[model samples]
Target chain A: MMTNPGNKVTQGQFSFLPDLTDEQISAQIKYALKNHWAVSVEYTDDPHPRNTYWEMYGNPMFDLKDPAGILLEVNNCRNALPNMYVRVTAFDSTKGWEAPRMSFIVNRPPNEPGFRLLRQERDGRSQGYSIVPYATDRPEGERS
Target chain B: MLDAIAKGTAAPDESVDLQAEFEASNIDEVMDKLDRELVGLKPIKTRIREIAALLLVDRLRRKFGLTSGAPTLHMNFTGNPGTGKTTVALRMAEILHRLGYVREGHMVAVTRDDLVGQYVGHTAPKTREVIKRAMGGVLFIDEAYYLYKPENERDYGQESIEILLQCMENNRDDLVVILAGYKNKMDRFFDSNPGMRSRIAHHLDFPDYGVSELKSIAEIMLGEQNYRLSEAAAKALEEYLPIRMRLPHFSNARSVRNGLDRARLRQANRLFASRNRVLTKTDLITIEESDIRGSRVFAEGKLEGEPETKAR
Candidate 1:
């Protein structure tokens, strides 16, 4: 799940897997396509620290023509995140599906870690996309 | 004979008859049977369980001189038509009865016609009869707002509404009333009857099915009819459905069922045209892409790219 600082993700938003690398996200997409498995992804534009989950179940429909621009026909999605903008991180050629990757910027949030915080536009702003660490076992100081 | 009579505890067989008492009770068995028949509606099921718990707690409290009389529950179901409102209401009646809330589990379903009589002088009896039937169980009124339509200046519907209000108040202990309709319509209905609104404590909203949900529903229907959809066909159908599902009516599960029926017919026609007397699994089971076709016109009876017709 993706959460941000300002907006609140409603019950109709997509519930995406959190803190995944681009490689991992791609691998999941490939696996889903091969197995014909449906997946749920969370997408959010809200800058709130807490994340909300909205469910969407469908196989990935990949469009290779536009690599950087990830677009798929969502079979069923909750109304909370209607017409939500998202970027895809992974693709499986065999299964014809893709999964959104972590660190994908929405509404011009920078992808770099230290640079993200510096790029903050105004008061209560951060420079880059501040990625939330997912591992619970790791101590707060140990996380990047 | 005197010696035998004097012996108060003669044998183990002379003790309390536990086996006979166990055989006489049937509450647990009835609940188990009902549970198996009720499917889907997990949230509603949880709510029902919660109500049952409250009722039990209230009963115990009363028995221990801590509480009052029977507790009445009110529930509102908002969903598209044929999404199992009436079916669930029927099951609820049985569950409530088995839980000892009411005497019998009989359910009475009504529309505006059943409540509001045709002419002047006929409204009260009609309303009363509906109340009489739903006394001990549930009165599930579909589109309940039509009871207050403004068309009739005499407005006999108001008479029916008054009677219904009285019945609900007087028979609160034994009867459960459920009003169901579209979300906006139901809100308006509630607004019209402030007294009825105050009594309804529970509200359950059922969302419209998305394309994938519709696909799953379609697949379930196909399986029930001993048929299936080819992979490509299924994907195509799913893609096509969402594009057509812009309208509220198009997104309904019932509409998906209708589409499946049409697709089945198309498949049957193709098979018959081939002059094959024997239908194989490949022929009858899988729904091919050819079996289904896209509609050029939208649900509102307008061509996809056509200009709107101006009103005269």
Candidate 2:
């Protein structure tokens, strides 16, 4: 055992996307990452009303692919929620690193918490809890 | 001597050359012409003049500054339906153009359906198209509340709103945007968007017309159509109108116009059966008491013939 307090597990500052170059999108992703928040992004090309959330990793880098199977690289890490699918198209990477290409699509589900919380609260209320006397006589802790 | 000279000249075609005189004037001409067509909107007229003056001043200011652009006057008109909001908006476009704020006095009225697109990517271009159409003149958005609905997370309405905010900011020097709807709903809409509330600086409220005003409006309409209401018939209409107008569904000016149209149809039917091809001066087309008393031509289950209830 070390003499110093060395076995501590420290939570790192959550960075959602640290590599995005576009300032607005980068800031938005940063905000989401900092707050453990989610964002709705149009992630598909079929023109469906679909959005997804991505779990933010160490540094957000997107592996983008186009309909033509061309890979584009996005290296800017910014804030993004887990499991969010962002609609993106592949583009050539500026870093010359064979990065996958993806274009910033319009954000959907503009408000993150509006519907989810309401649904959760409604479900909680519908599955109401029962109140019971917890070992009413608990035997006084078995008479100590 | 001058009185005799004026009177003896074949009564000087005493018809007064109303059209020629009315045409000679500018603002007053439009107002007078509209007065013959539209009735009993005294408050609206006053507000219209206020807006016209503002437009005139804005134009003068632009000229003084030697600017080639016009100033946009953002207004919010709140009232119930059929209170002549759209009519006033159309007239306002003409007045503003006459006052030299816009090159063309066209008014493009739109609903949410016109601006908001179904998909995410399509909304910006769609809204831009609407703004382009309304560039030179007034763009009137009716029932603006739908544009700020809280539901629909994938709301194309927000995209439209964002685009509209940008358009209003960018073209503040040229376009005039008027948002009109029920007062409470419009208040909610403004409350929803800070940008909208801040940009729309003028608010005009259109109050519902009373029975007397409605009657006057109806008489004006008849006068314009070359018909007159007999004294007893006018009185009966006044009394009958107050009662019918007190109903919740009854709309000002519009309701009165509808009632007059029904009465005219009834009179026409009666005249057709009486073998009268042309109406003589003495036998003028007049709205009669029986017309207001209700006839088979009037819709059934209506407030007609019912005990008159006072509007709250």
Candidate 3:
């Protein structure tokens, strides 16, 4: 139903809703811990949907029984890059469960300047569309 | 429209008439046009029909409250150039549209240059832009193997390939990507990139047109331009087709079309040289044997490539 050709980096679950509260985040971390899944936190200034390699907040808390440890790491990453996007991921090490099982963004910039859609008319009745994040218009690192 | 197909639930005893749904979709007209437009691709045609039938049946099943995962329509069109790959992709897009698989069936054709960028940060935006334009319908990527480059140390093509594979998997429901290129190169590409190979559902190999099919295609091309090849000219072309095929860069039907275009040019020049003579419409329209014979092809054997469009 979204008509704009622009792309928004809406990765992971519950992305369309508001940022999860600490209580909600704790509930999700607890659920992941219950399944014996390894919980990891990652943060990135370049949160492009295809930019899957986010900076890990230390090693994944493997074999950790407590959800409070992950919550601490998530907040730590958020404190370091308060204006950038941060996410918490759950991974299972069992055979055939190779990729991350679930992940969600828990931090976002206040303004969330979105992206600008660029269109160019090409030869032979062709058109090209691409998007640039609003923050990228400014210099690197200064982007919110 | 999608909701209409998704929401309807038939009673347990109700019958689903496939013929009625097929007629209502009006995809038969598109198939007929494909048959008329292309010279010969029997296997490809049958594959298209099979896919259409599959989609139609899938729609019918959905109507009966049957739950089946959406079928992956991403395809690989492997063949030589001028083998009607592009033409078939356009028709496939129409079929997808009529079947309600994609909203707008218009195809966006691109090659590696259109996607892979020269710089580190450039490839993502460029590839994403192309995907955005190609979101609703078909994205026909010709020479798709070029998106991956193991030889080039700092090439940004790998980045583009990663993004494309990601998009192809994540956006399967709305977008259909048809990767086309030389068959062997595509195989090698898949050999390196297993992710892409796994995602592709249909592999449509477009066989090269035979000499006879080339001749008929010439007639159709000439007819479209209101020009008819005289009997001798047709024979001249029959000779030309094989020679062209042997020479480097003989791109099947495209080469035939180009050869006819040259013949028409020569015919006009011959008519122009006989100045001060009133010419009949027949003379103007007819491509005489002499017109085609004048080509360097006759002076020299067709063993050599055309000097004008030589292979790189």
Candidate 4:
């Protein structure tokens, strides 16, 4: 999938960069493997800032040794969900906090619609602002 | 285009990233909440700050590549009933979560009955299920000493303890087990289950509130509910707390809360009886001298239904 650079949602580590090269992605995957981190691919049609949990493509690749194998899985996810967002996450278990230490966007749709900021005035001079994804607000079939 | 993009068009290290929006807020807010919510347990408060600070320092060190180890986050809270042990434990969970030590940062409080099943072959599944539910948060076992019943041969508490010990060691990265109970019973619990003691990283002792502290706690409680105590009412509480503290089944803060509840009931009845008169807002909010029916006052012969208004 391809995306307009300006409309691409900025998320994950290194999201400000253009889509990563295979070599660079492989390097990070290798690093995760070296640290015994379980690598997993997650995809989501929504990339809202507050959306923390993404739909995991499958179970974590815990026993994977070669980065190419994970790369294939990532590519397959990108192919199947061409219009959705895909990311590779590495979960490090050595630390007592079982959380994803590294996650980076690997794929995006061809036409990435950005987000909108909504503000509401509260009691007196107070106000609250919420960031809502324009893509998510659109009907599923019309999301592109 | 895909082939060209995959070849070498982008560099991994050459990029800016969005500033993560979900970075946890300052741990000071959690400490401030503890201070605002909890009344008086200076020792417990100090211990919590010390532990939070140490964990923060350790995290900073690891970030700077100075040192790295899996620091145990589990704790042991030993205290009397209603001494704010559960309150402190909940606050500590929030602090740990805010500091990035715990993922979910919530607590799942349970007792012996929640963990150990009544019959054989059921304890493991039950314990594991509870542990699984508490995977991303703190699992607080209140009155943890009750878990073990060495006197009762059929008690499955030890089996549950064994399963918990395994999970405590294996799933430590995701789970925190806090065993809390009375001081002496907890000591004996640790002595009996030696594995549990070694796994606990922090130990906090919640001392019973002094008379003055209990008075302040009651005052704070009343203040929150928009009820003010008169001077005589305050004096009554000061005298009543120490007496209650010496008695059996006398919970520290809980007793004060109960005393306040009784006073509120008396105030309501007093106001209801005077409902015929033109009453100001002040009349409804103040706890009068006559309304300070502490157990001491009830024990002694006191005339009730007296029409006296002495507002301080």
Candidate 5:
């Protein structure tokens, strides 16, 4: 399968994969629900790794026994943050588990302007480097 | 230290091309990654290349029916904290996996507390459990010298060590146990545990990163977070290193990471204090000189690393 390295949103599982269809998303939700994992929806204008604390759409739908409710919320987030990055997370309620059990990108902006690897040769063969996100050069709201 | 990559046999009259085998092994890609990700561990890198070359030669030897038993892959990675020992170990696992020395290239990093339990009849299971998880891959014991505590006559650490030694001997083919810690301490550990020393075929010492190397690591961290230092600010960071190193508890790369994080915070505070003005893209992304100068180290005309903050 052909893959675009630039558009590859690497935050979560199955991210290098193409956008998941509603059926696939729903299937994943069902799996999480079956395992008693709390499924929450979050979206962000910034997809940077350091800025992963995405604004949650609503509190985690921990008690929503039905998967359709989450599907509806995810669609709403997609509609609201159309130009931003939106993702879904499944958190295990088991004690001492701080990390999300599963997470995946649900929606992404069409124009995914990726980060450029900026290398500056300092002294000799050793190089100094920085990650420059192209889109962030523009203001937050103005970024695609 | 691997013995199997090119397995089975070539035809009686056929020749095996060394170049072809190297290309097929994908070990070069692993080596490339090691070079890119790790900053300054020259001896460790050379040892890895030597080991890989030896394994490649062993495969060729096998094709000619000059067979030898699987070599012991156990190792001792000694250096100071934050000296890329774990990073290099991870790469070593990938190399081993790609070259058919292991089933999975994943690394299981553990400490003494993880392997040795507090009470009686607990350490064997704990150590064995860690070993089981580390099967088909590499087991990295950070500060492994802690596992040998001879001060107490009846310490549980020895049980863990004994179990580990058994696993290292029996599962030489599938498992790789790497003992890692400070150089002098590791040397002492070996003197006490001659069995471990004898079993270990290779010892790779990770050297501490210099000021420039630490600065480069900080730059890479900055890049990952989509931030950059103004030219003067970068200079300030360079100046900050030597002063910081003179202080206590300065972990090489890790301290640099914390320093960058604090610098970013100061930048945020500076930007917020002057929020009335219209800020440009550079204003937001660039960490200016004042941001780095805000560090308490700068306020100290004489004192460095005194843990006192400059009260605004």
Candidate 6:
């Protein structure tokens, strides 16, 4: 199981996928529109396992209803920074919050370096394991 | 005008009921209190007015179909203890509520103890509960620097700070947070957590009250209670303040308040121990020089003072 190529960075709602397709992104946008949520695109160079906040490409798009319109923005973001990780986020204003309720990865770098598990030995001969992204362990420019 | 419309009375030129309602809810009274009630800290008062003006202008701009954005209402209050930080925070809540920036205008003050939990897996819910209570109002965190003690690895305060940072970003529309502490400690706090620093928009430094300002606070406190300080008593206070201020744990306004309380107690004791058969009205309400001079709380330099380095 550890050697499987299906190693994925489990983070937000749809982290199981390696990279979402254009059709899947469009479907998610449609769901957001049905729920009256605003869609936005965010990208980041350091997609560390613990990093939750990402820089938004622009403000949340409140007027767009068609998934194709959102796809254009997403594709543009992907093309602009092909090496960086990019994702689609949906913001909800319900329940007195302006939180990103749903987010999923749409694009990732070519060489997906996963995580490294660390082991710590205790005084009683017991051990502990900690998982951290291998990319963050290196310098920013050398992540890819 | 909206109130009039909702009342089903739309007379563009005049509406007496609407005018009265507007006058009642106007923030001018709250603003006037900030100017009148608090002593010194002119910069703090001015900063508050500037924020209020910005919010007001944003509202008007929105009405006119102009591009408007919500100003970051999170603030950092840096001052010594008893420097009117909490008072200003309360008045700020009232001002924001009147301006429709906040819903309730109430302030829930907390520290690390109230936000952080003692055990593992218990801090998030505790911090979230405080955030929920502070919703639609202001969350005033005193000695906020304690929320992050990098020296203590086992401490749960960092978890609480993380949760607070998240809420400060996600719930900016309805909630206003004010983190208050000494200038140096708060600076170090933001330094340790650079991400938390960027989220805060306003930084108001509450300067310590001068000797004269503390004296005036004392006079006001005594005057409000129908107690008059004699000429000699006032002189004693003026002299006492400068010396007390030089010592460690010199809380500006709070020390003055404590001094006044001690003077009042001494006056009561003096009256009861008097040889006169009957005490006159003047004797009952007057604070003599002896009353102000006799209390060694300031002279002893041990009036349950806050630590010079960290607030306890």
Interface RMSD of each: 28.2, 18.8, 19.4, 12.4, 16.6, 14.8
lDDT of 1 by residue, B1-312 (tens): 323322432343333333332333334464454455433556766777677667655543443345476665767888876465666677777767766676556778899888887787888767765665566577898877677766656889888878777767766765788877778888887887788788778887766666666677778778888989988778767655665576445636677777788888888888888874777779778888767553332224334543442311
Model 5 bad stretches (over 4 Å): A1-144, B1-13, B304-312
Residues B204-306 of candidate 2 have per-residue lDDT tens digits of 8888877777777888878878888888777767666756665557777877778888888877776667764766664556766666656432233243565
- Give all candidate RMSDs, comma-separated: 31.6, 22.6, 17.7, 17.9, 24.2, 16.2
TM-scores for all candidates?
0.54, 0.56, 0.67, 0.61, 0.64, 0.62
Please state the Cα-based DockQ of model 6 relative to the true two-chain complex.
0.02
Per-residue lDDT tens digits for candidate 5, residues B102-156, read 7666788999999999899888767766775676688999999999887986999
Q: Where in model 2 is the C-alpha error above 4 Å?
A: A1-144, B1-25, B31-43, B55-72, B275-284, B295-312
DockQ of every predicted complex: 0.00, 0.01, 0.02, 0.02, 0.01, 0.02
Q: Given the true complex, what DockQ would model 5 score?
A: 0.01
Per-residue CA lDDT of candidate 6, range B252-301, in tens? 99988888898899999988887566988999899998998886744454
- Pick by lDDT: 4 or 6, better one: 6
DockQ of 1: 0.00
Per-residue alpha-carbon lDDT of candidate 3 for residues A1-144, written as tens digits (9 for 90 to 100): 565324345889987676789989988987887788888888877765667888887667765544554665687688888888889999988899977888999988665667778998999979999876776687875666
Docking class of 6: incorrect
RMSD of 3: 17.7
| lDDT for position A73 in model 3 | 65
Is candidate 2 or 3 superior in TM-score?
3
Candidate 3: TM-score, chain B only = 0.93
User: Which candidate achieves the best TM-score against the true structure?
Assistant: 3
Give the range of the ten consecutive residues with the poorest summed lDDT in model 3 chain B.
Answer: B303-312
Alpha carbon lDDT of each predicted model:
0.57, 0.59, 0.82, 0.78, 0.82, 0.79
Which candidate do you rate higher for DockQ, 4 or 5?
4
lDDT (tens digit, per residue) of candidate 3 on B197-266:
9999999898988999988898989899999988888887877776677777789888887888788888
Two-way lDDT contest, 1 vs 3, winner: 3
